[model samples]
Target: MRIIINTGKGGVGKSTISALTSINISKRLKTLLISSDLAHSLSDLFAIKLTANPTRICENLYALEINPIIESAKAWQNLNSYLRELVKNNSLNDIQVEELLLFPGLEDVFSLLKILEIYKEGKYEVLVVDCGPSAETISLLSTGEKLNNLADTLVPLVKRFNSLLGGFIEKKTEVKKPKDIVFDEFVGLAKKLYELEKILMNPEITSVRFVTKASKVISNETFRASTLMNMYGFLTDCVYINMLYPEEIKNSSYDNLYLEERENVDRIEEFYPDKRVFKIYMKANEVIGLKELESLNEEIFSKIYLEEFFTACRTFDIKSEGASKIIEIDFKFASDKEVDVRRIGNDLELSYLNFKRRFKLPDTLSSRKISSYSIEDEKLKIVMDYD
Candidate 1:
């Protein structure tokens, strides 16, 4: 089982939730907690220095903070060297070319590759990933699809063209062709990405949990992030709203703040009616270390089983009713006014605010026409006709 904890905004106590959840799971199962956030706070939260390598934290728990720079040196040295040579050949200075070696998205790519490797090792029963902020997590989740597409299309073409060019260049010019080792490295990388996609798209094996605080800004961002997660075929089973002031403080000077927080909490509950939403009240002091985290975990999840908490609703399903086919999409937490739907050729385009997704029609529905659509039970059901 893989659990990825993320938040739409910073300072929402995401790492704290991640740490405590791992501790809770490790009590019954062998668990590994990993921080893929560049600005890692897991070390501080656990009060132990962590490196790129896994460090045993307790009896059944281990932790690691991924350092993408070090991982790049290990996994991307050949690709970086090739790009550097190409840049130098174009007359760029060494300093500029060296700076260019640190490619955009390399951190996310290497972090995911490391995750794939660790998950395949089968050493741990459960893997808990403490991802970066929501935006970065969304990008990382979508990376598998993008990389798989490149591997299937671009990488094969590049390999064939490079091989042909190598033979021609060797016969005509003194220029050195790229070595077979470089092409082999790329092939291996592509295979890894393809496997990663399989792991991520399996809803039974992986689920994303969103952590957020009670605020208008954070709530809005969480809604948008949840939509994107659904678009990427990731199951979101729960929303954790953290750091709420205790209700017993009604007579205190912070009454007004509590009132506002209550309103925000109400909005969140309404937004995720289909999801298991957990709320944690703020404590008198900061939460840190295993002892405090264990208490925190109990306060939030004592009533439920961790394994049962991961059971999620399907995002979309296809069913045939008599002569017609129905495609139902679970758009819970979203109103009809907030969503836009259209048909583009053989695909369906769905847009919610700033987020948009295009889904290809299944083979059975590819030749069918969209007879009608309706929003019912917070679900968008589209009817297609065989004729």
Candidate 2:
């Protein structure tokens, strides 16, 4: 199955593009449109009430607006139930137990795990995801790497506690099994999360598209997001420049605004030459529902070929210049953020602000020392020494 992930900052029209694209593909493929936004963007866009359950939109399309709590409950039922039981046993109320158990972004990451479950079910041929806001999308996509929650820190301790005290406890003791179950469940969740990361990074099966309006403020943010997503190994297949001013806007009172927006559009195209940049002009009437989406379907699908990626390009590359290996990291727009680099064995820990991504060095580079480094334009080039 093919997965198309649409992400952008709030008010960039991601839900619009995600909805229309799903409707167009549903004509032939069994498509599932999933939205994690609590604002009910999908529901409002389609003009149909949707719930955590997938609702039938048309013959081949089904849409679901996820409740993050429901998704977390489904994935972490055992752990959640155990924690609640432990807390309730302490004379805590249900509300108090829930308050303690709920972690910020726990359900958000759980909703992301739901994508892997849906993909494995093999029921739908296509999965269109309306990811959360751009910043949240970055964190959510890195769930596997940054899964250092309470449970994560507690896993090893829990497993060790069970292992140390197991011999003293009776074979039929129920407590031992529960402890083991907690570890097992956490392992299961971690495995699925890693699988989700793998699928998202796979260029052949998944493509991430950025949706943004043609405005300098938003374009600057979009450019930064593109740089960050590349660092995370997610392929930005194309960019959808939504809500452009129509021809009639020329020579009108809004002409200058239109002209400035046009320049932003051209700049975005130039910034992403390898990626197919498509424009969607603002319509005279509000575009909503299936009937209204048919015209937009032609506009988007006629040019965007879903079967293959808009471009298959690697985010980072290594080149042999004489003897040294030059490692280039696409780290533009990241200048605003301070970076701290540390090496642990053969892995490089790239830290910037709150986020840290580990890059495993190749054998050739692992044995060598980083002789020098420089930031040229958008790339961070590192020189590896043969000595």
Candidate 3:
């Protein structure tokens, strides 16, 4: 199954683009479009009320606005109930306990869990995700990996607590520590998270599309987003400059806006030179409903297969070059400017003007020094010194 995720600045009409893209996909494949954001627009866009349960939009097309809180309640019910029973003296109501049980930004993770759950059902050919804003979505895509790491450390402590609670804590009610039930649930969640990372990081299974307006600020944010997308090992295939003004209009007062917006696209093209860039012209009226979305889809994606619209280059790879080693990365999005590179022991840090990620190199490569870096065939090759 193919997963297409759309994210951008909060008001770049990403939902509209997602609607259009999913409508187009549903024409050829069984598709489900999910609004995974807290503030939803799919209902307004589709002009139909929706719930966590998938609602049919058209033949072979389904859409829903997922409540991550609700998903979390369902998934973590045993754990939450056990905790509440264990600490009944804490003056917190069920609602307050529910809120306290939720980790910061865990709703985002729950949103992904929702995606993973549906993806495993084997019903749909494609799942189109209308993600939250770009920054938050970045956090969402990478949260699985980070949370898994945290779980590895936290699970043992939880087991110890479960043992202590079983012996010492007086049970006010029939509820126990729930170690078996909790661990089973935890294992189930961990499995889902592993699948989540596996699917999201796989290039062939997932494609991320960024939508932005044609302006310097928004385009630059999109550029930084592209860089982060690479850092987290997610694939970014399309960058859409939405709501672009046409070159011709009768107003001389708006000439400068038009010229600057034109330059904005040029800058974005140079920024994302390798990726397919799409320009969405400003429409006279709001593009809503399946009819209008179908019309726009025909106007936009007429030339090639929808699959052709997605592309992702290598993010990070290592290889042996003679006696030395090399790290190959797709820094094409940040290649035009000075990218800061530094090494401290086995950790390598690559920072563009604004964003970067530090990586822990392998133990075998710890003795090797960073010799040099150069862009060869659109890849940033960082060579390690053997001597």
TM-score of each: 0.83, 0.87, 0.83
Cα lDDT of model 3 by residue, 13-128, tens digit? 99998888788888789999999989999988888898999999998899999987788887787787778776687787878877777867688878888898898898999999
The TM-score between candidate 1 and the true structure equals: 0.83
lDDT of each: 0.78, 0.80, 0.80
Model 1, span 1-387: residue lDDT tens: 564555557889889888877887887888899998888999998888988888999899999999887676667678777776655658677666655765787687788888888888988888888888888887776666556555666877887887879779856884557776777776677678667866876777777888999988899889878877775577888888998888997878989988998999999999877788888888899887777877887877666655444555787788899999988877655777887777778777777666666656778889988888767886777888866
**For model 1, what is the error of residue 164's alpha carbon versus the real structure, in angstroms, after optimal superposition?**
6.3
RMSD of 3: 4.2
- Residue 310, model 1: lDDT of 53
For model 2, the superposed segments whose C-alpha errors exceed 4 Å read 89-100, 148-154, 157-178, 336-340, 352-354, 362-364
Residue pairs that clash (backbone atoms under 3 angstroms), model 2: none
Question: Best candidate per TM-score, number?
Answer: 2
CA-only RMSD, every prediction: 3.9, 4.0, 4.2
